[model samples]
Target chain A: MNLMMLLEMAADGFGDRVALGPSDGGLTYRDLYDSAGAASVRFRADGGSHVAMADLSSAALPVSLFGAAWAGLPFVPLNYRLTDDELAALASRISPAIIIVDPDSPDRLTGIDGIGLLSRRSLMDLVDGADPPEPEWDMTGEGTAIELFTSGTTGEPKAAVLRHRHLVSYVLGSVEFMGAHEDEAALVSVPPYHVAGIAAILSNVYAGRRVVQLPTFDAHDWVTLVRAESVTSAMVVPTMLTRIVEVLDAEGPDGPGLQTLRSLSYGGGRMPSPTIQRALELLPTTAFVNAYGLTETSSTVALLGPDEHREAMASADPVVRARLGSAGRPLPTIQVTIRDDIGDEVAVGQPGEIWVRGEQVSGEYRGSAPRLTADGWFPTHDGGWMDADGFLHVTGRIDDVIVKGGQNVSPGEIEEVLVCHPAVADAAAIGLPDRQWGERIIAAVVLHPGASASSDELRDAVRDRLRSNRTPDHVEFVGSLPYNDTGKLLRRVLRSDLAHLGDGSTG
Target chain B: MPSLKPGSRFTSSVCTTQVIVVKGAGEVDLRCGGAPMLAAGAAADGGLPAEGASGGTLMGKRYVDQDETVEVLCTKPGDGSLGIGDALLDLKEAKPLPASD
Candidate 1:
């Protein structure tokens, strides 16, 4: 069942159970359900086939989402961060019958014609005006739970259709995987527009637990809420984790928030070992889980649970290193396999493209197929190997591998070494054009505050540590390296901006 | 502050007396002809176009001017009545607070 169905199945009185609230406050499930029902009815009256909500975080997004579900119309939560032109372009693409904007956005979207706009409060008021009967939407049984868009390879974002069945499956499987219970509440810090954010919200919602959402994440607010809400679980990206660790370390043991959290999750971007090391120190009892998946595969396809993490740490064997640096082992539901370019399964320890298939998988993206084979294994566009133990170890994106100077170089490998350096705060490795090496490796690094390291030192530090051709030929030390909001390093940005090579111009 | 861009920067404190709507998608002519520097919340470095500013109260707070074009469309179509205040204010900054370590 989708989250909406679970909400419907949950005792109506349970709506009184906190459905969602900001980190500082809350809303009853009943109130949420009623508001959604009303929004659904109003949506139908508005002649809206689907409703577009541009909220950052509010009781409104959930109300609209569930309300759209109750009404049998696809509820699209447009990213509120996009430029008007981008939003207009997306609206043109989605062609939603109606549009709802956060009161802070422009009343009418430029470029897009005829789409009506409504403020969130006004939408709620419109619901208040209506008689919010428990909505009885015609059951389609085969519709998607949510439609989220991710940056597409075509240079624009494409919507990924996550079916209700897939979402429900993710919820049930993820809860079991994470050892989450109904009594637990999770703190959601990422942008709701991303799959991780949506997963964090829905998993808690369907399980009927409090989802303490921070409208936007702040290091201070995250700790304060965890302390205040007694939040046992948290989902964070690497960048956010670094900040949380810093504040907690500064606050020391008396820092009330650190002790309360039990299980912490890291995903959407590879968690640097240094960051992970610090995280382990900060939340000693909390099982630092590495959740792995993509937008096409719903939320999580693999999970490296805390127990396995312990095993990886305890083992002195290099063979177990995959578990530590792993994206994760496949979850209970999905079937994962590594296949060579010719579509044949590779033996353990051979790198190949990752493919996944399951009920939790979306067969098509938007209306098209981004990954499909004549025989039907969804290509994950990631290069990795599955060991004899069936654990999957992801290296990086298939295209991210850099073959430079007759030697294969994975930027991720260089990044691994750079992040290990004490002075380096964050690092991203990209390839630069070169006369000698064909494709030269260049590293962009962000130094720790009050720390200073020259390109020569950073480069030599990497060389002395790993005697591979992977040492960066050049180093660009800027105030910061460019990264996507999800905390994944944007090597493309670095690759394009590295024309300066050594001169210190930021823009 | 690794996320901040060099050109456009937002203060941690609030900007503007009324609710602010930063309409930046339109091509702008700057000293440099690339992306305007975003205020630092998520994508201050302009690494990702969708790195939206974090919304919540900044400093004191910015009110939702229900009648404003951006506000009306943002909230609900045709419901010129209520506004979201103090929530997501820091996120609504005119420019992204660029990452500056």
Candidate 2:
């Protein structure tokens, strides 16, 4: 079924229960369904398949999305943060009909050829005016629900098709694995235009939970929402979490605060342990999650639960904890395997490329080549391994692996090791050019508040905690690590930054 | 905290704000209709909240995270009693994090 089915079912039982987390005003299920009905009527008569929206996390986006779904059309949510050039490129590629925008974001779209433009304010008025006819339907297969375009860090962004069935499977896995309850309130800070944010939105909605969302993520507003709403759950990234912890550290444990909060799901990138630990200390009652997956995978392939943190810390084996750095075990319905470079299955403990085949995983991209192997597994492009206990650990991007002096070092591995340090708030390791070792290990790190140490002290600290090979050869302090819109670390950016230095730039 | 000077423009009410480097009174005021927006206008008139404003300070509840506190501009009139558009904070200073295991 389409997103329409969800509204239909929700309306019968959960109507007026607050279909979406609050924004502009409380949009009831009746409002949502009726608006979708309006959008559907408009879509069929107008024949607009490509509906592009500029707002990231507004109720307008979702309403239009459901509107498209009811009409059995494809929904493309444009990244409001993208530059005009990027939006222009996407416009050339998709050529959408309805471009819903708002006061917060209005790009140069008035002159664009052959397109219908509606600001969020006017669009709502239109949806209200259109009297919906009977649900005369001609929707497509559940093959692709949202035609998500990749962030295009490595190259140009391409549409990654996510099917409706795939999304339903994903929702099931999240609700089951997360153990979220109905009364639980979720606060979403990540932009809904991204998968992590969408996951946060849909997962909470699917569970029929209350949600409190911030228009955007600001470390300040996030903590305040948690207190005012007593928001028990949230989904955010490491950088934001670090700042929240900093605020909490300066403030006491009991202030304008949360009461019913239970979790803060961390995704969009690997959770730096230092950041997670600091968050644990700050919002102690909130369970922390390290969720891992790609856009093609419908959001979550595996998750490192809060209960496993102790195990991660207690494990003396670097390889074991490195595995702990993994994205997580496949969800209940998923199967994860390690494949050799040639796509052959590797032994359980060996570090091979990670592959996944399951319901939640996409079979193929409509406009692109298939990402699966001959045997039906999706090549995650992530270097990781499946353990004896079936947990999945992610090392780094296979393409991101650095070859230095005949040693294979994934930046994720190096960063994971360094991030465990108490003083280190966040870290990124890269293979820098070296006359001696061809490419030497170099790390750029950020320190936690009220804590500071020299680069040499940090090097020694890692040496004390890890093997000589794994220890960073050089250390330098950085203000912050660069990140894409989705919160994924731009390792290549770090590599380039590291390249722009003298041999003695190591601090 | 020391670096933050007053005069940051606020849209809706915020819970806390730090590093508000507007350097003038004209920071973008976050609003939902008349109040601040929670998500994309979710909580509206309910984004951060009216309580975040205090003494017209922008760094208090309106711009901060939960349980955490900050100083803000009082939304009240300086002449005497609390006035219209006066900033009100949920609390004056930082709050502790949730106690952990």
Candidate 3:
């Protein structure tokens, strides 16, 4: 069905509640509903095939999103961090579009053909002045709701298409209507372009939780906002959580100083063990969730709940404690299977590619055919395994696996062992071409300040934990590793940076 | 009897109750307040709910038939109860999940 149905039900169920911003003078559910209806008239009148936002998160976000759905057009949010040329290139791809920009940079998207520009200020003005039409939206459930461009680490970015039915199914299956209390508020720091950012908006609105926006992420400002707004929950990427934990640790450890934050969820990348362990120790009362999903999956298909976090931390058994690193189990509506390279289902505790099938999984992209198999399972390029207890341990992207002498070696396994060393702050393992072996494993490491570890010592750490073959051929200490804004390690960048090691003359 | 499928909306003739089908298919006699329901947006004749069918429907709640083959989410609350033929729909219990967003 139409995404407008969710907003309509929220408006009808609790029209008077604050849906966004500060509670005292925020936009009410009815106000958001009316603004969406009014904004739809303008979107339809613009004669654009799609509605696009090239700005950060704000009240304008919800208005444009629902308005696009009401007008029966797909909403596209482009990364504002891109260069002018990059931004214009993407805008040209989605021509015949209305791109909403910040008032300060209204000229960001200028000189593009078939593109109408609307400053965020003027959009708000229209929302305030226009009259709402009657409740009417397409209900076929097949219209495109969002087109998100995957962060192109390897090559050109691919536009992933999420239809109304896919997104609505995600919201309906995972979230309850009016489940949140009136006092509950969620702090969102991720940019509008991320899939989690879009999911946060729809899920929070349907749950009747007021949203507090943080346009840019800074650990200190995040802590201040939680205190100022009495925010009850929040979601963050692993990098943001690491910085927040450092900020809390610097304050000295009676507590994290965030009393009202009852739930904190982290995803988008793998969480380092030290960061999560320190966070659990610092904020004992807060519920921590580790959600795992991809842009094609419409957000979280699996999550590790709070109780499991505590149990894993307290349990002395290594098997039970290792659950801390697991992604827990799949949602009841979703089915997850680990399959070998030939598409055969692998046994339990065996590493293979992750395949999922669910109503929420779109697995479709623009300008390409659907990626789903004839049987409806989508092969996620991610490598992972399920433990005996059914906990999913995601190793890393299958493309990043190092093939050494006809054996598949997961970089994540080596990096995890290296990071366990007290001297190592961060680590990354990449495959470099070798004459003797098909590929050689090179470990790029960043050491803690004033702490030192010999290359042999670090190699031994991995060899002790895993097979000797998994140990890195060489350990190169560096200042830091490269990670994207969303915390995904840029392995492609790492490979290019250390290409000299593969040269025989250099050795 | 009207053809039923997911995403179809219906309104009660006797009261203000409205629902969107979340499950079910094929033709069946879907009733509300002891009267046959009409497609959403259709005009309704003003009348009270039947004596035994006035259990009332709550907004944002799911109602399921005995076999659970049919499920509908009430979008508008009213004095009428949802049912099929003479069997009344039961309120589906919620399975609480932790907030992941």
Candidate 4:
């Protein structure tokens, strides 16, 4: 059940194929295998409790990941964007660890106590010169394989533990072995700390797809890499897609100049329907996929396939067209159920907490007991519901749901209506404290370039689409909204930013 | 007859084929090259396969028994074909879902 099993199979099945970087010059499956063996030896000799990387995505990521697995150590990838104090704090938590630092930024984490820092180049040199360790690896699935710190947009980050079995089940269930064509390449821009980033490396390697790494995400750089490397596929967050769509649209209405890209998957946050619509129209040749999952879930537990995307877009039925915003159906290997406040399963089309049960779902965090129930369902505090046809729609977090006059109002619904307006490019609806109602809705709208819309008009638009009660009590025009690096809208930030608008007396 | 479970490795006695059981329960006659497959790393009891048993297996292919109850993923390919009891297993079609990662 070790992650090495996957690499071993890849090395044996397609040892000569290039597994990462440019197809012409990248680490082959054999090269990665040997490097991992070398790394395992180094990790064992260093006697480190864990393998941690505070650097950006690079060739060293995969090597360190597999090496840590072969040596039976947890691989921890810390967010490199954190401040020095925050980064040091996280580093201290995983003390007595081997940390891989970006070679260019040698002084990034100077004087971090109780850690062994190795430059990327130095590690690569050691791997090249060292003897390969034995191929044997512990097969027990109980050992921790990865420790990913959840992106704490709301509060302090928690370390999520992923065991070997959880990860193995995810890969074996979702991905077909050597399913990709020899020429296929997957472009990965997400940071190493993200779950999608780790999943991308494992899935692409097993599928025999070459991986092209992008250290930092710039829409222009992403477009250029796709063109330059002949990248056939990519995974991006909603914000990254919006920017990429903008970049492509600025190229003129002719086409998105991404002929090589066959499939594009977006997740990590709620996608604005307008942006995705424009992208579908612009990249006619590419297949669009909307994947939904969390850090606890190995990766994607539910997905909207390409055909579904086109079908929903073309269908005239309002129900079918609306599914374009849905997260599609759950994966064949996963089960998704909606439950109400008291843990009772809700009726069809009822909004409630999203409870999932799957082998890949490890709802366990470090230092805390697993959140799974006695029977095994993990209550993902995310608010969502399933449609009549079984399509799942995720409405932001449950904690963010506004209780307005004893009615549950999802900010996403109101935000959706506001963004649909031609003048509105982006929007966020938050429930501000109100004396009349428990919470009053406030809309923060970002207009499209050179576009304008009055607060009354925006409220009327919401009233037209939904009930008047759902309309925002107040509307504030803004140039931009706050978002974490991973693209999750910082609703908490918005709550504070607009606190002055409502003080139990106002609104 | 070894009990089969997901992730349990098995080796063919008559050929180079090796497999990991993806599904199955209790004791079952999982065979390769018409000979019972051994738990991974077990010593082979007999020599090469009988003339008709050497049908061949492909790397990265999945083999399933009748009624679709038994499934095994071939981690290594060999000359011997996969089987259960007296029936030869069929190559499972590669149903690839969209790459979501």
Candidate 4 per-residue C-alpha lDDT over A1-507 given as tens digits, one digit per residue, 9 for 90 to 100: 778989999999999999988887789999999999999998898888999998889899999999999999999999988988898888888888989998888787778777888888888999974667778887657899999998776678899999988898788878999999999999999999999999999999889999999999999999999999999999999999999999998999775489999999999988999999999998898999999998898889999999999999999999899889988999887999999999999999988999999989999999999999998899999999999989999998999898899899999999989888999989999998888897999999999988888999999999999987899999999889999888889999998888888775653
Predicted model with the maximum lDDT: 3
| Candidate 1 residue lDDT tens string, A369-411 | 6465665468888888888787888878878787677666777
**Candidates' C-alpha lDDT:** 0.64, 0.63, 0.91, 0.90
Q: How well is candidate 4 docked (DockQ)?
A: 0.58
User: Interface RMSD for every prediction, one decimal?
Assistant: 18.9, 17.5, 1.0, 1.6
**Model 3, residue pairs in steric clash:** none
Displacement of the residue A59 alpha carbon in candidate 3, Å: 0.6
Better of 3 and 4 by TM-score: 3
Runs of candidate 4 with Cα error greater than 4 angstroms are: A504-507, B1-6, B22-29, B42-46, B50-54, B64-71, B87-94
DockQ preference between candidates 3 and 4, better one: 3
- Higher-ranked by TM-score: 1 or 3: 3
Query: What is candidate 1's DockQ?
Result: 0.01
The TM-score of candidate 2 is: 0.76
**lDDT at A393 for candidate 3?**
88
**Candidate 1: Cα lDDT at A218:** 88
List, residue by residue over B12-49, the lDDT tens digit for candidate 3.
Answer: 99999999988889897898998989999899877988
Q: State how far residue A341 of model 3 sits from its true place (Å).
A: 1.1
**Each model's chain A TM-score:** 0.91, 0.89, 0.98, 0.98
lDDT of 2 by residue, A226-330 (tens): 776667777777677767777777677665445566876776666776666666665656566677778888777777776665467568886556544666566
Per-residue lDDT tens digits of candidate 2, residues B1-101? Answer: 12222322222334322222112122233332224322212221324333433334321112222332332322211111111223322322322211110
